[model samples]
Target: MKAVVTLIFLGLISIALCAVSIGDYSDKNHPGKCNIDGRILPPGIHQSPTECERISCGDNGFAERASCGKKMIRNCIPGELVDKTKDYPQCCLRYFNCNGEIVKA
Candidate 1:
């Protein structure tokens, strides 16, 4: 009986650790990446009108429309890129987990 109880306790501990370490990534609502739009986008914004519109959406309360978009641009800058075609600035790259260390992409 003692051995069985000890084994059960160890099994529970292992299961708990695994559950805590594994996270869901399939959910579209999952937190990831950064969206820089309107007023907060950095220099060298994209040239596509659609991109521009997306950025402007921020001013029109679009920021509150999508949770992920809002999460991405909450602190981003909206602006034109240097060539209007280059890559926009990345915001999520600067974030990390609870620890002060930076998480690798």
Candidate 2:
């Protein structure tokens, strides 16, 4: 009985440690967003209307600003890339009243 209880306790502790290691607990300011070295990043594509404007969360976890009119804007989050045409099709593609939706053009 003692050995069984000890094994169960160890298992629970291991599970808890794994959860903590893999959980998203960095962003204390913004929920559901990643806080990479104190910068909060959104999930989807972030855009700026002005050219040479500095985006808040650009470049994969590097806090770099991507220029407007570029073909692709690097997302701060890992494994995410935002197409400038899709984010701002009006400016890049000459479409009128584009809603910045992820749609097939």
Candidate 3:
């Protein structure tokens, strides 16, 4: 009985550790993104030289701009899509860059 209890306790600890590790990784990967089961996390917030802004992640995995400066423009694209800098206007267009960093185009 004691051996069984010890085994169960160890198993529980292992599971707990794994859960914590996963949570840490997720938070680190997507700071302001929501946590939805089976959904991919959106890109991180855009950090400009003057200010920072984040994007909103929809349940359908679409991203939208959440904030912008007075003269800055915001744009949204699918997380899986490549950043089409040339296609966007010269105005600030927010999207996830190739390096996964939120950037302004």
Candidate 4:
């Protein structure tokens, strides 16, 4: 299980780096506020539209991004996904229960 988890995490790194989205604020007219993708964002951290990312806002109106990267095709026989509903890093922590379906781990 440990090895599988490690492999999964390692695989995520390659996928994660490319998909990182830096926040772009179009509200240059108003400093300290951000208008991203037509959404008004105050100063704070926000979840990206994809829900796979964490965006942070500040005085500049731009949101910082926390990317979990992307998933690549794997050779493993993927079964029911071992998933948890949580935030950012936690959300990215996932694996496949190939041997059986894990109702709760």
Candidate 5:
């Protein structure tokens, strides 16, 4: 009886914790954030030091730029793609090189 009650309480707590949303934010290390639906991995950053930036992600860098909703990608100089599972062939690069810490938008 006691064990059953304890198990139920624990399950409820787990569900509540999982319900919390982390929004969209990711990087080379943290590839994604947990949201209401599920995990959401934001765009990557292709670092560049040259005057003309060359973002090689997909479709003229439009998709990557439009990612993260309102969040803007910056400080991406001489960037390189580290993780290819989530942010490869689609997402941006050098996510850690952003001007500031990664924030969910």
Candidate 6:
């Protein structure tokens, strides 16, 4: 019984440790490469293969992703909102009518 309890506890601990990684690609895993959808990207900003996120792969072998910064409707006169139906950058890039002028943001 004690042996079984110890094995179960060890297994739980291992599972918990695996769960702690939030899927961030690091140098420890693939040095200087951002592996997105099985395609290796060098250290630089690149578009995600499966999402609208802009991935920035640092030289340190870490990846940081960004999409639309924030949706701002202030001073926008019926400006264009994000069209999720579109592709990568076009999906997030929006045009706004500010002060009666069309502004691309």
List the RMSD of every prediction in angstroms.
17.6, 17.5, 19.1, 7.3, 17.0, 15.4
lDDT by residue (tens digit), candidate 3, 38-82? 344554433222223233454343454322233322343323223
TM-score, each model? 0.20, 0.21, 0.20, 0.51, 0.20, 0.41
Residue-level error in angstroms, candidate 5, position 7? 0.1
lDDT digits (tens) for residues 20-57 of candidate 2: 11224235457556564454666544445433233344
- TM-score: which is higher, 3 or 6? 6
Tell me which of candidates 4 and 5 scores higher on lDDT.
Answer: 4
Stretches > 4 Å off in candidate 1: 20-105
Model 2 residue runs over 4 Å out of place are 1-26, 34-41, 49-64, 68-105
Give the lDDT ranking, best first: 6, 4, 2, 3, 5, 1
Better-scoring candidate (lDDT), 1 or 4: 4
Candidate 5 TM-score over all chains jointly: 0.20
Model 1: how far is 35 from its true place, Å? 30
Q: Which stretches of candidate 6 lie over 4 Å from their true place?
A: 1-24, 27-29, 69-88, 93-105
TM-score, candidate 1, is 0.20
**Worst window of 10 by summed lDDT in candidate 2:** 72-81
* Global Cα lDDT for candidate 6: 0.63
Evaluated at residue 31, the lDDT of candidate 3 is 60
Distance from true position, residue 82, model 2, in Å? 22
Pick by TM-score: which candidate is best? Answer: 4
- lDDT for model 1 comes to 0.30
* True lDDT of residue 35, candidate 3: 46
Error of 1 at 33 (Å): 32
Give the range where candidate 5 is weakest over 10 consecutive residues by summed lDDT. Answer: 61-70
lDDT of 4: 0.61
- What would the per-residue lDDT of candidate 5 be over residues 15-77, giving only the tens digit for each residue? 443212122333334434222122232344443232112222322222222221112345533
